[model samples]
Target: MVNCVVKNWQGEQSGETTLEMPVAKEENAEHIVHRALVRQLHNQRQGTASTKTRAEVRGGGRKPWRQKGTGRARAGSIRSPLWRGGGVIFGPKPKDYNLKMNRKERRLALRTAFISRVEDLIVVENFLDQLTAPKTKEVVNALTRWGIEPEQKVLLIVTDTTPDNLYLSVRNLPNVKLLRHDCLNIYDILYADKIVATSEAITKIQEVYCGE
Candidate 1:
């Protein structure tokens, strides 16, 4: 369990909240989190890279020269790895890079990683109505009030019901990543310099992750 301060749109402390997600044990926290991160990154690879071997190359059926050459080395075929424009000796081929982890372990890793960033987590009250139009400047000003710098990377977590105007307002910021509560991932959680989650999103996170 962890306690967090909830700030309003103006960045004033309006209330407080708590997160009670189950995290991994301290002894195995790093290892489990690393495994989860690696699995996610590896699974995203397309694995389309391929190379031809000597046996698979075209025109390799006919030998290039006799076993005992006059002056040059004895060559088996023109597609030999040693020859120019020849097949590759050892090269990459298409393969699945996906890694598997149990659902319980994955959840544990996520909870642990999220909790570890408590100091950088900023919980704010839902201000969906604050944005009347899709203006990037308004979002920047709000972020500045929330103690986030212009150059810092921000991960803004919102509920599914959040208005499109708010999303439009935040989409133009290069350093800010807007994600729904249910779409949270290890990469975004760990990569952001600051995490700003709305109060309702925090509740949704607990309800989604803390329950069986």
Candidate 2:
């Protein structure tokens, strides 16, 4: 079991919570993590690149000139690939870039991501709920008190519904990402230098990925 320090809203150490060793193993398969990351990145692509073909371009209905005696190569339409301002040949088309991974692959992937960053994980109790007003300085002070530097990318995982104040407070902070509990994934875990997880967030993560 790994002992994670549980810090309160005031930035003081409240207590310690235990994480199952099976779920917090430090040694993770790099290939699994890499594959999961690649899949995630691939799915994120918008894949909207597109180019018009000869038939799609307008003002191409009529031939440029007489086909039989033209000094240049014979052309059928003004939009022919051979003509100026012509449509592109073999150009890219809009496509779906999403890649799917099975349940087993995804489960292992999330587990790997969490385990790989065991040492950097900070489990904070849910004093964030008490924050009714958005205060950027409050978030900064909390992290500072916890000894977590904010300059590096930090991933904050909260319970199902992140409170309005917490969301607004961290929303515009530089290098800080606020995400809900169930949405945890390999990309954010690996991308972050440190992870600040709420108490409920840990339970949710363990419930979903610890089943493996």
Candidate 3:
């Protein structure tokens, strides 16, 4: 059991919580995390880049000049790759850049990443209810109380039970990201310097990831 400090909105230690989720037992767990990051970044590519090839270019129907009578080099097509307005040669085409990741591997990678970052996790009990309104100043004040600097990247993990005000409050804040436990991914976990989670959010994660 990994015991962690649970803090309130004021950054005071409210209690101690244990991480039921499995921790990485391997010393080389970071290698799996790196693979997961690479897979995530690769999967994000749109792969929609396209270019017209010489064969697909139009206006090449008639020969520009006789095959062997032109003073200059004989041109068979106006849209030759050598011409100014010619089609691109060996240009890019739309392709799927999506990388495949095994489901078990992804889960293990996430577990490893969370274990690696467990020290940075701050459990804010009743975080959403702390501030009733969607005020940026209030959010900033809460984070400030938690000793979080303004420019620090934070990932707030919430759950379906969390209020809309919490989402609206932190969306525009600098370097702060909000995600439901269901939507939690390895990218956000690795990108954030600190992760603040509501007790409810922790419960949700435990249900999905701590099942063993």
Candidate 4:
């Protein structure tokens, strides 16, 4: 267990919290990479949006020409991919982009990512109290106290439910993102310069990644 000290909105010392560092687990690097890639693919697909294809465009119902009669090649609907303003050829469709990775692989990737973050010294003090609401300045001050820059993008992982105050406080900060224990993602972890998580979240991460 590692001891970390975090401050609250009041600028007072909020005491210490004990967290098990799961990033130190001696897991397979290959497994971790596979899991992280799967997660990246999953996130991309989950938030995907559907866009209309040219073939599905309106005003393409009419045939442009008669077959074998005109000098032009055999023609179909006006929306044919060959024509200008026609439907796109082999364009992206609205489908699931999710990649199915094995459970063990996913766990490994998460572990690997956690290890990488720890190696970078990005993981910091764990918070204990749930602030009444999110306060951007408060979070900023906490980071400043820890010698982290205010402009750094920080990922805060909370155990269980997300506190209302913390959520609201970091919402407006472009560099900061708030995630629940179950919602940790490889991209987010990789993108963040610092990670602030609760003890419960740390434990959950360990169980999921290290099986500890």
Candidate 5:
């Protein structure tokens, strides 16, 4: 069991809450974490890098000149990759970068991430109601009052729907990302320097993934 300090809307320490760590299968933890990390990486990739190929580029419908009679090098079409303003050669194309992970692996990864939070002592009190809107200043002030650095990347995990104000306020902050309890990903957990979550989210994770 971990004892964490809860904070109120006024940024004052309210009280303490006790939570039990979920018991997870050690054998599956690593695999789950790996898959979740991979999934997150894949999701982040836009994979929108696209270039026009010879066939897709405009023009080149007719040969530029006679194949062997031209005073210059033999030319097949104007859209050749060697020509300027021509189609790209082996250029990147837009496509899906989504990667599929087994359900068990995903669950395991989430559990492992939670376990790490527990080990790191990063999980803190749920402060969902602390801010009414997406005000970066308010969020920064709250973190400052709690001794959390505003410059560091902070991941806030909410157990349920994050209020519009909370979402709006944190969206513009460079070092902050709003995540739901059920949406906890390994990449976010490991990438962030700190984790701030609501008590409800903590309990949900322990119940669903750790079976505490």
Candidate 6:
């Protein structure tokens, strides 16, 4: 359980909120979180890299020099590994990089990672109504008021009910990444220097992750 200060759009402390989630034990917290991170990063790989071997290359049927002394070493095919424009030797082939972890372990890892970043989490009131239109400047100014520097990376957590205006307003800000509460991941949680989450989004996170 942690206490977080809730701020309004004006960056004033309106109230406070409590965050309680089931995190892993300290003994293996790092290990589980590391596993989850590696799994996620590895699973994102396309693994579509492929290279043709000598036998798979085209135009390799006829022997290059008939295996006889023609003032040069005999060559079996033009597509040999040693020849120019030839097939690759021991090259990479398409493969699957997906890694698996139990659902419970994955959740535990996520909870642990999220909790570890408690110091950087900033809870703010729902300000969807504050933005009447898609204005990037408004979001930027709000971020500045929220104590976030312009250059700092921020992970803005919103709820599914959040309007597209907020999305449009924040999309142009390269330093800010907007994510939904339920779609939260360890990568984004740990990647951002500061996490700006709406009060409603925080509640959704607690409900989904804490199972409350």
Best by TM-score: 6
Tell me the spans in candidate 5 whose CA falls farther than 4 Å from its real position: 1-31, 68-70, 119-138, 160-165, 168-172
Local distance difference test, each candidate: 0.89, 0.82, 0.82, 0.65, 0.73, 0.91
Clashing pairs in 3: none
Q: Model 1: residues >4 Å from true position, as ranges?
A: 65-70
- Which lDDT tens digits does candidate 6 get at residues 1-212? 89999999999999999999989989999999999999999999999999999888889898767666688987888898999989999899999999999988888999999999989999999999999999999999999999999989999998863568988898889999999999988899889999999888888888888762
Q: RMSDs, each prediction?
A: 1.8, 2.5, 1.6, 4.8, 3.6, 1.2
By lDDT rank, best first, the candidates go: 6, 1, 3, 2, 5, 4
The 10-residue segment with the lowest total lDDT in model 1: 160-169
For each candidate in turn, the TM-score is: 0.92, 0.87, 0.93, 0.66, 0.74, 0.97
lDDT of 1: 0.89
Query: Where is model 5 poorest over a 10-residue stretch in terms of lDDT?
Result: 118-127
Q: What is the lDDT of candidate 6?
A: 0.91
lDDT per residue for candidate 5 within 63-83, as digits (tens), equals 788878567989889889999
Better of 2 and 4 by lDDT: 2
Q: Which candidate tops lDDT?
A: 6
Clash count of each predicted structure: 0, 0, 0, 6, 6, 0
Q: Report clash pairs, candidate 2.
A: none
Candidate 2 lDDT by residue in tens digits, 91-208: 9999998988887777787786787798999899986666778998888888888778768899988885545888788878888998887788888899999999988788877887
The predicted structure with the larger TM-score, 3 or 5, is 3
Off by over 4 Å in 6: none
The TM-score obtained by model 6 is: 0.97
**Runs in model 2 with CA error above 4 Å?**
21-28, 67-74, 160-162
Model 2: lDDT of residue 22: 49
TM-score of predicted model 2? 0.87
